[model samples]
Target: MASIVPAEKIDVIRRIEQLAVGAGLAAIVQTAIKLGIPDSFDDGSVTVDELAKSAQAEPGTLGRLMRALTVHGVFDEVEPGRYTHNDLSRYLREDAPIPIKYLVLWMGAAWTWEAWPRLTDAIRTGKAVIPDIYGKDFYSYLGAEGAAGMGDFMKAMTAITALSAAPIVDGFDLTGVGSVADIAGGQGRLLVELMERFPHVSGTLFDLETVVANADPKLLPGGALADRTTIVHGDLYDKVPVDVDLYILKNILDAPNQQSDRALLNIKESAKPGAKVVIIDALMDASVEELRVTTLVDLFLLLNVGGARHNTKEFEILFEKAGLKFLGIKPVPGTFPTQHLAEALVP
Candidate 1:
């Protein structure tokens, strides 16, 4: 056995302590989001006293949190004690692009806070702590909360997707694809962007009835493809548009169980025999460090909607099940290895 050096031991101890400190800081941000601190600050800068009054926290306590958060680059300490939205905190604003405020509150304060504390139970049992924490699966909880909860969850997902959007646009080619259909495309954002970029490509944004109901034409700016874009309300488990030459499914099947095959089969059945089907979802290779994040995503899907991330083999099975032939599995640059752009042909 190798003897432990005193200095090395001290270093390890310090790193463990730092991890605890990071967890504490995250807790503070959680509390702030739960207390509506971000929303309050969204309008403009406010003094600690004003924030305290709004949050119903004592002046002294609130000031301390604000200072710590400012140091962390979340909020800005604009004039010593006064505070304003920094880039990090502004992202928590409800109307801000991706609007992760409720998501922060939900995960940080709600599910994660409870789930993490009982991680030992999960470890021992090798079972999800979601039912134990929330008394139900995550999706059931959200479905019970109705549209408001769904909107928050989707916003959080969109926030995550937004981070990798630029890389996606760059990695995938849309130059010559004439008719594109975005299956289970929420709110039509990605398809709209793709259509706007490739003026020659007409598109359809397909989503659930409720989701398509909320889509607005104004979201797609360029008039060149305006007439070409249609919002189609349909169930991916049922059928996909037949005439579309290009089919894109982004982060759709990761949410539900066995629906990946269902969605793909539908797309394959209706698609032109040689139509391109692009599947963009979390794909984990056997060797990768960000595999932890991918693993967590699997749990998130299981706990939330009985869905999960697929390995390369699992994806191949789906392709076979769907009567689609694999064309390629490529990685988008500047993203995690688990994020794969799997292109298949509807055969």
Candidate 2:
């Protein structure tokens, strides 16, 4: 084969094939997870018939699905017609620290998955395709879907936070910062973690009313963090509360529309002079693997919310426009996807 065709061309074709089948693989994985197939193997390697019965799936069909996933290294076919756990498949476990189950469910959601086919349309129209397909904005759809919908969304965010928050909390210097405010802080995960770590510093968790109402009770009223953390409900674009020394805009600025600028300005206005604003997000200009990840995320932002991941230079421009002084961007070491702590000072 190598003699007949150049290796480079063959590699290109292989990559295209992988990309083409990406959605199919995701669908299979999502289906298996939703069926609790991974949990069925907890006792050890199980035959196709046993596993299928446990997962409530057809034995032959589920066997084929498991074989395909095994080819992708999601599970181990220790012997013919039997499967067991692998590093990749274990993530589907219900109690995994970073439960990827929720992330998979959210990404495989109808509105989200359907929008990918309209990426070209979004590019042509210079708008997110979510509204065109779903007849409403992403957040509005989540709201209309009610508690179960929003809970899954929060679970996905919480999973991501579980991985990144520890690195972020330890990376920054929180000493002497009298108070901190986490804007659009979903489930108050980061704020709760920070307050627990730095008991000397008080913190406020700010987000939309519905989001705050669904925040983890362990972080709110009469809970572990209640004494040191105040959970407030409000839109980041409208107001971010005032008089906090540190304003954390972790995932806030990456929202669609002009919310980034408006929210940054709101934080600027709400902050006292010399307040520190830290943006915890993935920045461009990283290693090849990191760039690939961040670039994919930037595209997803376009598809989901009309936002794009930014580099330090782009953030400098945003801060300048929002009337804040750019301090610098610091990398949060020991993170999986690796994020930056972009710092700016309120003027």
Reference-based TM-score, model 2: 0.94
Q: What is the clash count of model 1?
A: 0
* Tens-digit lDDT track of model 1 for 1-347: 56575766988888888777966876888877877888886657899999999999999989988887888788888797888888898887767866666556555535565566665665576566677766887656655666776666666656666666667767777656788888877767677667666778788888777666655454445544558887777777788765788888888867544667788877877887878888887786635577756776676555545567787777777777778888878777775334678888877
Q: What are the clash counts of all predictions, listed in order?
A: 0, 0
Candidate with maximal lDDT: 2
Model 2 bad stretches (over 4 Å): 1-8
- Scanning candidate 2 in windows of ten residues, the lowest lDDT window is 1-10
Measured against the true structure, the TM-scores of the candidates, in listed sequence, are: 0.76, 0.94
All-Cα superposition RMSD per candidate:
4.7, 2.0
Local accuracy by lDDT, each model: 0.73, 0.83
Candidate 2 achieves a global lDDT of: 0.83
